[model samples]
Target: MDVSLKNRFLKSYFSFSVGIWFSAIISFLSVPITSWLIEPAEYGKATMFSTIYSMILLIVLIGTPNGFMRLYHSVEEKRKLLWSSLVVPVFLSVIFFGFVLLFKDTVNIFLAGQKNSKAHLILVFAVFFGVLQTFSQTVLRMQEKGFSYSALQIVSAASNVLFVILYALLISRNFYAVLYAQLFSNILALSLGIYLHRESWFPIKIDKSLVKEILAYSYPFLLSGVVWWLFGWTDRIVLRMYSTFEEIGLYSAAFKLVSVMSLFTSGFSTFWYPFAYEQYEKNPNNKELFSKTFDYISFLILILALLIMSAKNVIFLLFAKSYRSSAYIAPFLLLQPVAITMAIVVARGIDFAKKTYWYIISDGVAAAFNIIGNLLLIPLLGAKGAAVTTGLSSIIVFAIEKAASEKLYPVKYNSKRAYVSMLILIIIASINTFFERFYVGILSSLTGIVVVTLLYNDVFRKLMKSFFEFLNRLKSMNK
Candidate 1:
């Protein structure tokens, strides 16, 4: 890459990454505060509500955002393209809402109490705004306006936090309040997003050919999303079914803590498709580039896992004493993102080859494993069982996806180094889980850190060298 292009990528990466990092911090802060304010059972119920909402949102979206991003750069009538993307999701969402109405009693069973009718209605709005926010943010990204995209993201996150705090203070801190906060925050963000991109909403003509193309690209994501959602949330749903809400609450809290890993993964996710597609378009022969990129990203995520796992105790201290037991699963849960990152990096192979059916198959198998694993384990072991099984399922999915992707579109990834790092992580995590001694956990963490550093010394040096070189340039410019 040329210096200018490399610098632009780095700048855009950090610009957007800082927004995700800030959002993660805000989200992390909300958990302990919300947990403290609400009853454990209520917190669990609210979390259950959010989980269901996420699943529905995924279904309603039908992976259109990914389709939109993929097609955005190529299409001439971006406005029509954007509006066309919205039509199917909006139509599907309405149909889903109708079904929710038809099955009012069934939906309320999960929600239980506190204005059940109102909560369901607000949930529909949340899903609507959620889809809108996703498209608007993606549009900004498609335009390469990283700073604006980051601004809106930070605003949405900040507004959510602020709303939660206000709701807890002004109203009740129960599930109702949580739902109300979510509804208002989504509305606020969506309104701002629409205002920012109001011009694009015009000339709303449906291009049949473009719509077909987007659907062709998005269909696999639609299928894979459903399977992926099941894989991600079956543990919680099963816990709700077989176990108690309190256990669910504890598990949910651990998930919130582990979500900090998204601060890193989220940034990469935003950059990856656009970056990957751009690189492939420029040079399809850049196999080594993709492979090295995967190794480097996997290692970075491992570093994040190491940092979070090592500080698991300190991090959990922010939770209520009743909720602190949630910390035990943090080590396992922290690795979830690592597994996800590996799959995402390697999946580039399948994406370039346009064989998204592999994703559907991979995720379907993994979701089944997760469901079966949760069933067998939750009854026997509780939250810890859920954690162990979930981690194992994630790794299974990654392995399957990587194997399939490599076979289809070979990328000469540094498999040995990557596998070694993963092995070390698994061992150290197991040690920490079993021993629970402060020194043992710390020692295991140090060992993992050492292994990662040894494997990634070159990447580390290059990063540091870039930092110093940038600083030197800044100094010269100021002088």
Candidate 2:
């Protein structure tokens, strides 16, 4: 990498990292606070409400945000592209809203189950704002406005904490309070997001040709998004069907704790797509660059997985007593993010090539397997089964995506290094989950550090070299 480009990348990276870390902390604090305030069953139901909005957002947007990001590279009129993406999705959302009203009774029964239909209705509005929130964030990212993007995230996270605290303490301490806080926070962020990207909203032109192009690029992505949702959320849904709300609560709590991995994945991911796509565009056949990037990402994820599993006890302490089973579930659930990180590394091929149908294939296969796995496993093993199934399903999806992507853009990743790191992680995680001893956790942490270091010594050396060089350059420039 050129020194100037590398420096700029690092600057953006640190900006994003700091912002995301702050956001993660707010989220981390909020989880326990929310868990503490509500009953386990209520918390579970609240989580389900969040999932309901996620499903609705997936349908309403139809992957247009993704196409918007990718197509921004080629589109001449950025505002027009934004208009097309927003207009079509908003139109679809309106139609979907009508359908919701028409089938209010049936939809309420299906989604709300024994809960109140009124909350689900509020979530419909939340879904609309949430879609806008996502679309606006994508525009910020595509424009490479990392600082603004991070600021928006900080505001969202802070507002979420504030609103949830207010509702829980002053107003109500029920699941509805949690949902309402989230809904209001999203609205706040959506409004701010629109203001930030206000340029994209105006002179609204419904460009039929642009909409057609965006849909063409995003069509496969739509299916992939649904399948990805299933891959991610089906476990909870199936578990809800087979188990009690307490179990769902436990699983959800554990999942939230393990999202420590997502802090890293998402923070880097915020910077990665734009960076990776730019790198690919600059030199399409730079196979080694992609390969080395994948290796580094894989190593980082493994290290994070190890640390989180080792510190499960510390994480569990933050939760209420009723949610403590989340500690044991955390180790297995941590693997899900590792798999996701790996998938992100390899999925770039399909993304860059615009062969997003491969994403559908990979996500679909794993989602189907996960649903079946959950049905079988949740009946026998309960939450643990769901966690294990989620991990394995993600791993399978990563493998399939990597295999498919390599055929299209043959990045020569160090497969042995990645595979071995993953295998060691699996062994260490299994030990931590099953053995459940402080010594085992300690030993596994040490082993993970040593093994990963030995496996990626070259990468580490280069990373250190780059760091020192960067520091020296900074000092010289100051002088």
Candidate 3:
């Protein structure tokens, strides 16, 4: 049973991991051509608009998807629950978009919103597409069709490259052009998702009781979403608020670099809830399952951290002449994956407990910490301040969530190994932090990761077995 489960996870993990890398690759491919077509300022505006759009999405969805994940496994009431949970977000989305269409000017000055008054209508359409797109994709993720889901995502992503290249190179640089492309991508994704995972959505009906339960679960993120996004996005918006577009450009580049960590965590974390829920189903009372999940995930994060620290300089230097600032922040950014992985861990426990309120409260606290940190730090430190605040906030959040998870579940999180692993990471971070040089520290970090990875002989043996099995699976497919 364990072997089969582990194998499945490895396959799922690998697929999602490759999907992330592919998405990154496609984005890079589109970049030079797109940049040649549109000025940085225009591209920056589009990026900023999307960020605001995502923030607005929080209100429209009002915690539905997050709530859905938290409560779906517990929903005995079922169908009405699904319908009930979805209705509010959909209705609210329409209403909110309508308001934005109406009050275009007020949105910018008062709402901390975007300045693109002319593109407000297209923005609404894009946001609506985004909500529907998320709803459809969430259904597939819940169904555990990892390979099919990833393929659907890849198709949309690849299409994005085509459209971006076409629009940027051959068409207008109007923000709506980008918006139209995004809307099309979402439409394609929704279509592909519905086509591939037709089973879960069908015969779908409302469950009032289940809906209430899920809403209750999601209520936390709904609240947390607002504050969480504000803090998450505050640095960028604040830069626009306080500084010039040119300064915003530098900050945007740095922010884009850090978002890589989020991408890395997204797939793993997306699968995490379902994975945990499944384990709990199989062994409802097995503390070992939770402990093992945490350890395995922690170990994985450690490996990634080591790799990022090692490769930060070479990667940024290789990517673009303008993106040199990434090296300055990548090490600090690398530390973020640890906190992020732990946040997901906490979120998993919170999700399973059906205590959605805790999720909101915890996020609120973390958001508060970030906001205060940014306000105090950004004025003094600038772009680096933003990075520092983000990294520290992640750690603070992880610590808080870990405490909360411990309280609710009362399991050993295998912290002794975690502590040792973190100590090694800290040494690497400190070396870089002190010298503020990439090469020597990077080499040291790379060497340390190798030496430490070797320490777990049992782990290495298991990894080799898994690798061979994966290779064999590929070999059989070729036959």
- In candidate 3, how many Å is residue 265 off? 1.7
Q: Which 10-residue span in candidate 2 carries the lowest summed lDDT?
A: 111-120
Clashing pairs in 1: none
What Cα-based lDDT does every candidate model obtain?
A: 0.80, 0.80, 0.69
Among all windows of ten consecutive residues in candidate 3, which has the lowest summed lDDT? 108-117
Ranking by TM-score: 1, 2, 3
Each model's TM-score, in the order given? Answer: 0.89, 0.89, 0.87
RMSD of each: 2.9, 3.1, 3.5
Instruction: Summarize candidate 1's per-residue lDDT along 234-265 as a digit string, tens digits.
Output: 89888988899899888888887778887778
Q: Write the per-residue lDDT of candidate 2 for residues 1-479, one digit (tens) a residue.
A: 56686677778777677778888888867776877787877776787778788888888888888788787777778888888888778888788778878777776666556534676577678877887888878877777788888888888889887887788889778777778878887888778878867887777766889999888888888898888876777887888899998888898888876777888888788877877776787788877767777877787788778877777877788777888767777777887889888788788888777888988898889988898999999999889889888888888888999998888888777887887887887787777767767787778877887899889998788878988987999999999
Shift in Å, residue 473, candidate 1 = 3.6
- Cα lDDT tens digits, model 3, 1-479, are 38887778767777666666677777767778776767766776677777778888887787888776555566664444556677778777789777886788776533324564556766777777788788776766666767666776787888876777677657677554566677778889888777766665566687666667666667667787787777667777665655656555566665555556667687787677777776776576777767766666676677777776677666667656776765665565566778778667655565666666775666777787877777786677666666667776777667777777777767777666666776677677656544667678778788768866765445657677878988999999999
What's the alpha carbon RMSD for model 2?
A: 3.1
